[model samples]
Target: MLDPILKRIASSPVLIYILRCCIGFLIGYKLYITYPDFELFWTLLSIILVISPEEKDTRRLSIERFKSNFIGSAVAMVMLLFLEPNVYTIIAGIFVTIIVCRLFNVLNMARVALVALLIIMVQPHQTGFVEAPIYRFGSVAVGCIIGLLIVVLTSIIFRPLKRKFGIPY
Candidate 1:
């Protein structure tokens, strides 16, 4: 009985998403309450786990994520130096960033571009171009690392996942 229930829970994507969201929200809320400055980092990490591809696909996603972020942030910094940023400017930058990322043929590069655009436009003073890009990149790196660690730790401790799934160790 417990085995069938566990299998069903593992197999259901919707259930998994719901669970992840709940957990993410709780963790995000706690982080926000404890350290508001770091809330976004934790929240974004949670979201990353929800959107992350399978373990086998993580390598490609991680590579694309890193490359796109670095390039997009650089482009955003150059743009910021040239133009005065406003809502319209930020939106336009996002469009341009997306186009460029798509040209590069990197998966989810648009998301990285959006992140870069937001960092430049929304929090320029708090984190200048010189430092913001590094901070943004660091946030992503930390989040992905934590997410991967969680996956591995859960798999090891629970030991419920079947070997037949062909997931990389």
Candidate 2:
């Protein structure tokens, strides 16, 4: 009976998704403990973006995510260092992120980039408005790494299961 249940989980995508989610949540929990002030919002967002119930190209998503984070962080940092924090700067970040995505033909990254821009713009002043972009950039970069790691781990665990189920590896 236990073997039958294990085979069902191995045969399905649900188990992989669940495992991936656990990894993300564990990161979030660890961060929260280490830094009491750590807002879990971005971590949760990362989990949602990284783990999918459906099959996806994790590599493509990871690349887009990293690029988008870099673009948003760089734009936000430049704008804050040279100019005053204002709505216009946020708008400019959005436009720039969109343009870059178009240039790279990775339009799907626009949304994630835009979110990064918003995060930078609205960051708490106590932490110094200047630090927002840097923090946001790091957060998303970690997310991308976690996403890739999940993909690799899932593939490794599932390959043997595929054989056990008499499915092509």
Candidate 3:
């Protein structure tokens, strides 16, 4: 039993995932310090949460996420600038984000965009509308970039380890 367990641990996808998650956490902590906004935490969390164990198109995913984040942030900022912060505006912003995501055919990033909209529209942030979206967008964009970089860099570093350990990464 011990031998099998050890083999599985040494040859499974666990090490790569562990490395990616640690990288995410480190980046998140750094961003939290750099950006005074509390929303920065969640932006990083979202990126980390999306880190896949299976190999995929990280560049395409990052592009989709950034585009979706921008759409949501821009729409919410426009609404906040021109209108009052109320249920109608929030709902309108949500609807608009969904529509825009569909139009762009970026359904993969719709949820991310909606989250950006919520970050901008939901709370009466002390930073106000413009600043709030900007911060949210900044943190999210950074997280996405860093997360993809981690995946790429870690993949390179882990390839040899995977080979030696017979890991199925």
Best by lDDT: 3
lDDT of each: 0.54, 0.66, 0.71
lDDT of 2 by residue, 68-167 (tens): 6556656666677777877887787778778887887767777766776676666664355666555655665566566666766776777787787885
Model 3 local distance difference test score: 0.71
Clashes of each: 0, 0, 0
lDDT of 1 at 92: 73
lDDT of 1 at 164: 36
Quote each prediction's TM-score. Answer: 0.54, 0.77, 0.70
Q: Which ten residues in a row have the lowest lDDT in candidate 1?
A: 160-169
Model 3, which residues run further than 4 Å from truth? 1-11, 34-39, 53-63, 158-169
Question: Per-residue CA lDDT of candidate 1, range 76-164, in tens?
Answer: 66566677767777777777777788888864656765675575456645455555545554554444444444444444533444343
- Cα RMSD (angstroms) for every candidate in the order listed: 5.2, 2.8, 4.2
lDDT of 3 by residue, 1-169 (tens): 6656555544656655776878788888887888664567755765674565554554456567767776777787778778888999999999999999999988778887888778777856766656665666566666666776777676676567657667654
